[model samples]
Structures are given as structure tokens and as C-alpha cells.
Target: MPSITLIVNGASKSLEAWDPDMPLLYALRNDLGLHAAKFGCGLAQCGACTVLLDDMPVRSCSIRIADAAGRRVVTAEGLGSPEKPHAVQAAFIAEQAAQCGYCTNGMVMTAVALLRAVPRPSRDEAKQALAGNLCRCGSHERVLRAVQRAADSERA
Candidate 1:
């Protein structure tokens, strides 16, 4: 077993994994007990297990735990709390962007990264940024609106 140190949700955590190639999602959910990132498709196409790695959106299900060592990993739980939700999270709630809510984590995390990179992205840009994330409930419209709403709130 290898002990890997990771910065998760602004906190440092030491996790042990038998295989260095173990997916980051396992360490996050099993070891660290962060459930915000869900496992939809282990293949990384669904984006259900998305998280922010050094402020960039990444698929935790595909990233090896060793590769995430020493990196700043921010799961959806790290994004905000129920009381003081992140702007993107608030916008998602306000827009009712989630139907089943399985994909909300990925959508929110990816939107946070997108907003950080492009403060105010057009609808097309938002669509492009979220193209990788899939919502089985087909809440694309609301998700886009939530991203725009978050952008507006950030500006204000």
C-alpha cells in the first residue's frame, strides 16, 4: 500500500491505496468520505465524477490516485456549504438546474471552472464547456441558465 497526501477541499489528507493507479474517485469517496463527486460512467465520458484539479475540471473516475497526489483537489463539497453556497451552486439551485441531481456535481464544478476561466461566457461557450458533462434528465437548458446566472452574480 502507498500513502498519498492530497489537498482536498482546502484540507490536507493522507490516504492509503493498495494500487497507485486506483481512481481518485475511490479515495475521495471511500477514504476521505466526500460524496459530492459521483461515479456515473467509470469510463470518464459521463463526467459524473468531475472535480476541480488545480482549478481545472477533471474526471476523478479516470485520474489515478497517484497522479492527484500533491494537487489541489476540490470536490463539490468543497465548493460551498448549504448556508453559504458558491455562486455557481446558488445559481444552480435558483435555476433548478437539477432533475435527478446525479450530474449536478459535475455541472456545478465544471461551471465553476468555466466561470473562473471566462468570467462571462456566452451561451455557446457555456454549452461548449459543459458538453462533456451529461445530465440524464436532460436539464441542459436550466444548467446553461444556471451558469449564466452564476456569471451575472459573480459580476455583481
Candidate 2:
């Protein structure tokens, strides 16, 4: 087994990966107990498994653990705490952006990255940013609103 150390959230963690080819999602979920990134299509088409890899959104399901060695990985749980949620997380709650809540993790992570890059993205830009994330709960409208609200909140 090979040992891989990852900077998860803001802390460093070392784990023995029996197979370095294992997806990073498993290490985050099974080993580190970070469950925000859910298993979706597993092929990386769906953004349910999105996480910030070096401040960019990447599908955790397809990113190999070996490839992510010595990189910054921030899952949705690492975004914020319940008492003080990230702007996007807080906006999601305020706008009721989630029905089943299955896609919220990816949405928040992507939104966070988008905001970091673009700051105040237009409605179309937000939609484009989240186009990959699937939310079958018919929450697209709310999700859009949540992104805008988050931008506004951050501005304030």
C-alpha cells in the first residue's frame, strides 16, 4: 500500500491507499468521512461529485487519488459550518434551492468557485456555471435565485 497525503478542507490527512487508482471520492467519503460529495453518475458527466481541487471544480468520482496527491481539496462540508454557512450555502437555504438536497453539494461548490472567479456573475453566467450539475427536483429556478442571492450577500 502506498501512503498519500491530501490537504482536505484546511487540514492535512494521510491515508494508505491500497490502490492509488481509487477515486478521490472514496477517500473523502470512506476514509475521511466527508459525505457532502455524493456518488451520482460516476462517469463525471454529472456534477454531483464536484469538489474544489485547487479552487477549481472537479468531479471527485473521476479524479484519481494518486493524481490529487499534495493538492488542496475542499468538499462542501469544508465550505462552512451550520452556524456560519458560506454565502452560497446560506443562499441555498434562504432560497430553498434544494428539494431532495442531493445536488446542493455540487451546486454550492461550483457556485463558490464561480463567485471566487467572477465575483458577481450574471444570471446567464450562473446558469452556465451550474449547467453540469443536475437537480431533478425542479429546483432550477430556486437554484438560480440562490446563486444571485449569494452574490448579493457577498457584496453586502
Candidate 3:
């Protein structure tokens, strides 16, 4: 096993990974105990395993642990807490954007990236940013509203 160092959620962690090619999702869930990134489609087609790698939304299921070395990885667990949630998270709650809640992690993470890149995105841009993420429960409208609400809050 080789030791890999990662900066996750603003914290530095050294983890033992037997395989360098092991998906980052495994290390995050099994070793680091971060469950926000789920395994939806191991192929990375679904965005359930989304997380922010250096402020960019990435599919944790397809990325190798070795590749994530020294990068800033932010999972949903790191995004916010009950006391002070991230703007996107607070918006999701305010907009009631989740149904089954399986895809909310991806949606929120992706939204965070988009908002960071574009402080105020148009409706279409918000839709395009979330195109990769799938919500089986069909809460697309609410999700859009949540993104907009987050953007609005940021401007306020």
C-alpha cells in the first residue's frame, strides 16, 4: 500500500491506498468517511459522485486517488454544516429542491462550481451547468430555483 496525501475540505489527510488507480470515491467513502458523493453510475455518466476538485466539479467515481493528490477536494460534507450552510445548500433547503435526495449532492456541488465561475448565471446557464447531474425524482424546476436563489443571495 502507498500513502497518498490529499487536501480535502481544507484539511490535509494522509491515507493508505493499496491501488493508485483506486477510484477517489472509494477512498473518500470508505477511508475518509465522506458519504456525500454517492456511486450512481460507476461509469461517471451520472453526477451522483460529483465533488469539487480544485474548485471544478469532477466525477469522483472515475478519478483515481493518485490523480487527486495535492488537490483541493470538497465534498458535500465539507460544503456546509447545520449551523452555517453554504449558500447553495441553504437555497436548496429554501426551495425544497430535493425529492429522493440522492442527486442533491451532485446538484449542490455542481451549482457551487458554477456560482464560483459565474456569480450570476442565466437560467439556461444554470440548466447547462447541471446537465450532467440527474435527478430521478424529477425536481429539476426546484433545483433551478435553488441555484437562482443561491445566486440572488450572493448578490444581496
Candidate that would win on lDDT: 3
Off by over 4 Å in 3: none
Off by over 4 Å in 1: none
TM-score of each: 0.98, 0.99, 0.99
Candidate 2, residue 1: how far the Cα is off, in Å: 1.3
Weakest ten-residue segment in model 1 by summed lDDT: 9-18
Model 2 misplaced regions, further than 4 Å: none
- Of candidate 3, the 10-residue stretch with the lowest lDDT total is 13-22
lDDT of each: 0.94, 0.95, 0.96
After the best TM-score superposition of candidate 2, give how far the Cα of residue 132 lies from its true spot, in angstroms: 0.5
Give the candidates in order of lDDT, highest first: 3, 2, 1
lDDT of 3 by residue, 74-138 (tens): 99999899899999999999999999999999999999999999999999999999999988899
Model 1 per-residue lDDT at 139 = 97
* lDDT tens digits by residue: candidate 2, 1-156: 799999999999999999999999999999999999999999998899999999999999999999999999999889999999988999999999999988889999999999999998999999999999988999999999999999998899
Q: Pull out the clashing pairs in model 2.
A: none
Better-scoring candidate (lDDT), 2 or 3: 3
Query: Could you tally the backbone clashes for each prediction?
Result: 0, 0, 0
